[model samples]
Target: MIEVAAAIIENEQGEILIARRKKDKSQGGLWEFPGGKLEPDESVEACLKRELREEMNIEIQPYESFGVNEHDYGSVHIRLFAYKATFVRGEIVLVDHDRVEWVRPKALKAYEFAPADVKFVELLERE
Candidate 1:
Protein backbone atom coordinates (compact mmCIF):
# COMPACT_ATOMS: atom_id res chain seq x y z
CA MET A 1 0.00 0.00 0.00
CA ILE A 2 1.19 3.49 -0.76
CA GLU A 3 1.54 5.79 2.22
CA VAL A 4 0.49 9.30 1.28
CA ALA A 5 0.66 12.47 3.32
CA ALA A 6 -1.93 15.18 2.77
CA ALA A 7 -1.79 18.68 4.18
CA ILE A 8 -4.84 20.52 5.41
CA ILE A 9 -3.11 23.88 5.13
CA GLU A 10 -5.02 26.89 6.35
CA ASN A 11 -4.04 30.51 5.90
CA GLU A 12 -4.39 33.30 8.44
CA GLN A 13 -7.78 34.14 6.97
CA GLY A 14 -9.04 30.62 7.86
CA GLU A 15 -9.11 29.43 4.29
CA ILE A 16 -7.78 26.00 3.40
CA LEU A 17 -5.59 25.22 0.40
CA ILE A 18 -6.66 22.72 -2.24
CA ALA A 19 -5.17 21.79 -5.58
CA ARG A 20 -6.53 20.49 -8.84
CA ARG A 21 -4.71 17.50 -10.30
CA LYS A 22 -3.16 17.88 -13.70
CA LYS A 23 -5.48 16.55 -16.40
CA ASP A 24 -3.02 13.94 -17.57
CA LYS A 25 -2.37 12.43 -14.17
CA SER A 26 -4.19 9.78 -12.25
CA GLN A 27 -7.36 11.04 -10.60
CA GLY A 28 -6.92 14.03 -12.80
CA GLY A 29 -9.13 17.12 -12.63
CA LEU A 30 -10.11 16.46 -9.04
CA TRP A 31 -9.44 18.79 -6.17
CA GLU A 32 -7.41 17.46 -3.24
CA PHE A 33 -5.63 18.60 -0.13
CA PRO A 34 -2.18 19.23 -1.61
CA GLY A 35 0.39 16.54 -0.74
CA GLY A 36 2.10 13.44 -2.07
CA LYS A 37 3.29 9.92 -1.34
CA LEU A 38 5.89 9.44 1.36
CA GLU A 39 9.37 8.56 0.33
CA PRO A 40 11.39 5.76 1.95
CA ASP A 41 12.49 6.49 5.52
CA GLU A 42 10.75 9.84 5.49
CA SER A 43 8.68 11.01 8.44
CA VAL A 44 5.08 11.94 7.72
CA GLU A 45 5.68 15.58 8.59
CA ALA A 46 8.82 15.69 6.50
CA CYS A 47 7.01 14.16 3.58
CA LEU A 48 4.25 16.71 3.83
CA LYS A 49 6.71 19.58 3.93
CA ARG A 50 8.77 18.25 1.06
CA GLU A 51 5.76 17.51 -1.10
CA LEU A 52 4.25 20.94 -0.58
CA ARG A 53 7.57 22.51 -1.51
CA GLU A 54 8.24 20.27 -4.48
CA GLU A 55 4.76 20.06 -5.89
CA MET A 56 3.39 23.44 -4.96
CA ASN A 57 6.49 25.56 -4.39
CA ILE A 58 5.35 26.67 -0.96
CA GLU A 59 6.58 26.16 2.56
CA ILE A 60 4.32 24.76 5.28
CA GLN A 61 4.55 23.63 8.85
CA PRO A 62 2.45 20.51 9.39
CA TYR A 63 0.87 20.16 12.77
CA GLU A 64 -1.25 17.54 14.50
CA SER A 65 -2.81 14.66 12.69
CA PHE A 66 -6.19 15.47 11.23
CA GLY A 67 -7.34 12.02 10.06
CA VAL A 68 -6.58 9.02 7.89
CA ASN A 69 -8.26 7.22 5.01
CA GLU A 70 -7.55 4.09 3.04
CA HIS A 71 -8.85 3.64 -0.48
CA ASP A 72 -8.36 1.26 -3.35
CA TYR A 73 -8.36 2.55 -6.90
CA GLY A 74 -8.21 -0.86 -8.63
CA SER A 75 -4.63 -0.41 -9.75
CA VAL A 76 -3.43 0.91 -6.42
CA HIS A 77 -4.31 1.14 -2.79
CA ILE A 78 -3.33 4.13 -0.69
CA ARG A 79 -3.40 4.97 2.99
CA LEU A 80 -3.71 8.71 3.31
CA PHE A 81 -2.52 10.57 6.37
CA ALA A 82 -4.02 14.00 6.83
CA TYR A 83 -2.38 16.67 8.93
CA LYS A 84 -3.35 20.19 9.86
CA ALA A 85 -0.79 22.67 8.58
CA THR A 86 -0.04 26.36 8.38
CA PHE A 87 1.52 28.07 5.41
CA VAL A 88 4.97 29.26 6.38
CA ARG A 89 6.21 31.18 3.33
CA GLY A 90 6.90 31.38 -0.40
CA GLU A 91 4.68 32.26 -3.33
CA ILE A 92 2.44 29.53 -4.69
CA VAL A 93 3.59 27.75 -7.83
CA LEU A 94 1.94 24.82 -9.56
CA VAL A 95 4.10 21.87 -10.46
CA ASP A 96 2.13 18.67 -10.16
CA HIS A 97 -1.21 20.42 -10.22
CA ASP A 98 -3.06 22.59 -12.67
CA ARG A 99 -4.51 25.05 -10.19
CA VAL A 100 -4.57 25.86 -6.49
CA GLU A 101 -7.16 27.69 -4.45
CA TRP A 102 -7.63 28.93 -0.92
CA VAL A 103 -11.21 28.11 0.03
CA ARG A 104 -13.41 28.12 3.08
CA PRO A 105 -13.94 24.68 4.59
CA LYS A 106 -17.66 24.62 3.86
CA ALA A 107 -17.02 25.69 0.31
CA LEU A 108 -14.89 22.58 -0.38
CA LYS A 109 -17.95 20.49 -1.10
CA ALA A 110 -18.49 22.31 -4.36
CA TYR A 111 -15.42 20.71 -5.90
CA GLU A 112 -15.20 17.02 -6.78
CA PHE A 113 -12.31 15.50 -4.85
CA ALA A 114 -10.34 12.34 -5.41
CA PRO A 115 -11.92 9.34 -3.69
CA ALA A 116 -9.13 9.17 -1.15
CA ASP A 117 -9.74 12.79 -0.20
CA VAL A 118 -13.51 12.71 0.25
CA LYS A 119 -13.35 11.86 3.94
CA PHE A 120 -11.00 14.73 4.69
CA VAL A 121 -13.25 17.12 2.80
CA GLU A 122 -16.28 15.94 4.74
CA LEU A 123 -14.50 16.44 8.05
CA LEU A 124 -13.29 19.89 7.04
CA GLU A 125 -16.76 20.91 5.96
CA ARG A 126 -18.05 20.16 9.43
CA GLU A 127 -15.43 22.38 11.07
Candidate 2:
Protein backbone atom coordinates (compact mmCIF):
# COMPACT_ATOMS: atom_id res chain seq x y z
CA MET A 1 0.00 0.00 0.00
CA ILE A 2 1.15 3.56 -0.67
CA GLU A 3 0.56 6.36 1.81
CA VAL A 4 -0.54 9.74 0.51
CA ALA A 5 -1.33 13.13 2.04
CA ALA A 6 -3.84 15.59 0.60
CA ALA A 7 -4.19 19.22 1.52
CA ILE A 8 -7.62 20.87 1.77
CA ILE A 9 -5.58 23.95 1.28
CA GLU A 10 -7.87 26.82 2.28
CA ASN A 11 -6.99 30.36 1.50
CA GLU A 12 -7.91 33.41 3.58
CA GLN A 13 -10.98 33.84 1.43
CA GLY A 14 -12.34 30.44 2.47
CA GLU A 15 -11.61 28.74 -0.83
CA ILE A 16 -9.88 25.40 -1.30
CA LEU A 17 -6.80 24.88 -3.40
CA ILE A 18 -6.78 22.36 -6.22
CA ALA A 19 -4.11 21.44 -8.72
CA ARG A 20 -4.34 20.50 -12.37
CA ARG A 21 -2.18 17.60 -13.51
CA LYS A 22 0.10 17.93 -16.50
CA LYS A 23 -1.20 16.33 -19.66
CA ASP A 24 1.53 13.66 -19.66
CA LYS A 25 0.97 12.45 -16.11
CA SER A 26 -0.88 9.30 -15.04
CA GLN A 27 -4.05 11.28 -14.32
CA GLY A 28 -3.30 14.00 -16.72
CA GLY A 29 -5.36 17.25 -16.62
CA LEU A 30 -7.35 16.01 -13.68
CA TRP A 31 -7.77 18.38 -10.78
CA GLU A 32 -6.72 17.19 -7.35
CA PHE A 33 -5.23 18.19 -4.03
CA PRO A 34 -1.56 19.12 -3.83
CA GLY A 35 0.54 16.63 -1.93
CA GLY A 36 3.01 13.81 -2.42
CA LYS A 37 3.77 10.30 -1.21
CA LEU A 38 5.14 9.95 2.29
CA GLU A 39 8.68 8.87 2.93
CA PRO A 40 9.49 6.31 5.61
CA ASP A 41 9.98 7.50 9.19
CA GLU A 42 7.80 10.62 8.86
CA SER A 43 4.45 11.09 10.49
CA VAL A 44 1.40 12.05 8.40
CA GLU A 45 1.56 15.61 9.68
CA ALA A 46 5.25 15.84 8.95
CA CYS A 47 4.78 14.31 5.55
CA LEU A 48 2.15 16.96 4.84
CA LYS A 49 4.45 19.72 6.00
CA ARG A 50 7.22 18.47 3.76
CA GLU A 51 4.99 17.90 0.77
CA LEU A 52 3.45 21.38 0.98
CA ARG A 53 6.92 22.82 0.86
CA GLU A 54 8.12 20.62 -1.97
CA GLU A 55 5.00 20.76 -4.09
CA MET A 56 3.72 24.28 -3.51
CA ASN A 57 6.51 26.19 -1.76
CA ILE A 58 4.24 26.93 1.17
CA GLU A 59 4.48 26.25 4.88
CA ILE A 60 1.30 24.75 6.20
CA GLN A 61 -0.14 24.67 9.65
CA PRO A 62 -1.81 21.30 9.46
CA TYR A 63 -4.26 22.13 12.22
CA GLU A 64 -6.48 19.11 11.78
CA SER A 65 -6.79 15.65 10.32
CA PHE A 66 -9.97 15.65 8.29
CA GLY A 67 -10.28 12.00 7.32
CA VAL A 68 -8.69 8.91 5.77
CA ASN A 69 -9.94 6.98 2.79
CA GLU A 70 -8.55 3.76 1.43
CA HIS A 71 -9.01 2.99 -2.25
CA ASP A 72 -7.78 0.61 -4.90
CA TYR A 73 -6.11 2.00 -7.97
CA GLY A 74 -5.85 -1.23 -9.95
CA SER A 75 -2.62 -2.87 -8.77
CA VAL A 76 -1.81 -0.49 -5.97
CA HIS A 77 -3.68 0.22 -2.76
CA ILE A 78 -3.83 3.86 -1.69
CA ARG A 79 -4.21 5.19 1.83
CA LEU A 80 -5.03 8.86 1.70
CA PHE A 81 -4.84 11.11 4.73
CA ALA A 82 -6.55 14.41 4.20
CA TYR A 83 -5.80 17.58 6.14
CA LYS A 84 -7.14 21.12 6.52
CA ALA A 85 -4.27 23.52 6.11
CA THR A 86 -4.04 27.21 6.86
CA PHE A 87 -1.56 28.79 4.49
CA VAL A 88 1.42 30.00 6.51
CA ARG A 89 3.80 31.53 3.94
CA GLY A 90 5.52 31.80 0.51
CA GLU A 91 4.36 32.33 -3.07
CA ILE A 92 2.30 29.71 -4.89
CA VAL A 93 4.75 27.58 -6.83
CA LEU A 94 3.87 25.13 -9.54
CA VAL A 95 6.65 22.62 -9.57
CA ASP A 96 4.56 19.61 -10.62
CA HIS A 97 1.22 20.83 -11.96
CA ASP A 98 -0.02 22.43 -15.15
CA ARG A 99 -2.33 24.77 -13.21
CA VAL A 100 -3.60 25.57 -9.71
CA GLU A 101 -6.89 26.95 -8.44
CA TRP A 102 -8.54 28.24 -5.29
CA VAL A 103 -12.20 27.45 -5.51
CA ARG A 104 -15.33 27.12 -3.43
CA PRO A 105 -16.71 23.69 -2.55
CA LYS A 106 -19.78 24.07 -4.76
CA ALA A 107 -17.67 24.93 -7.77
CA LEU A 108 -15.56 21.79 -7.39
CA LYS A 109 -17.61 19.87 -9.91
CA ALA A 110 -16.63 22.20 -12.72
CA TYR A 111 -13.21 20.59 -12.90
CA GLU A 112 -12.55 17.01 -13.89
CA PHE A 113 -11.16 15.70 -10.65
CA ALA A 114 -9.23 12.53 -10.07
CA PRO A 115 -11.33 9.66 -8.76
CA ALA A 116 -9.93 9.78 -5.27
CA ASP A 117 -10.11 13.54 -5.23
CA VAL A 118 -13.76 13.38 -6.27
CA LYS A 119 -14.48 11.46 -3.09
CA PHE A 120 -12.61 14.08 -1.13
CA VAL A 121 -14.69 16.84 -2.70
CA GLU A 122 -17.85 15.10 -1.56
CA LEU A 123 -16.51 14.97 1.95
CA LEU A 124 -15.67 18.66 1.78
CA GLU A 125 -19.08 19.62 0.50
CA ARG A 126 -20.80 17.66 3.24
CA GLU A 127 -18.84 19.53 5.85
Against the unseen true structure, what C-alpha lDDT does each candidate score? 0.94, 0.86
lDDT of 2 by residue, 2-43 (tens): 999888888899899899989988789899888889899888
Off by over 4 Å in 2: none
As a whole number from 0 to 100, the lDDT of residue 19 in candidate 2 is: 94
Clashing pairs in 2: none
TM-score of each: 0.98, 0.93
TM-score of 2: 0.93
Compute the lDDT for candidate 1: 0.94
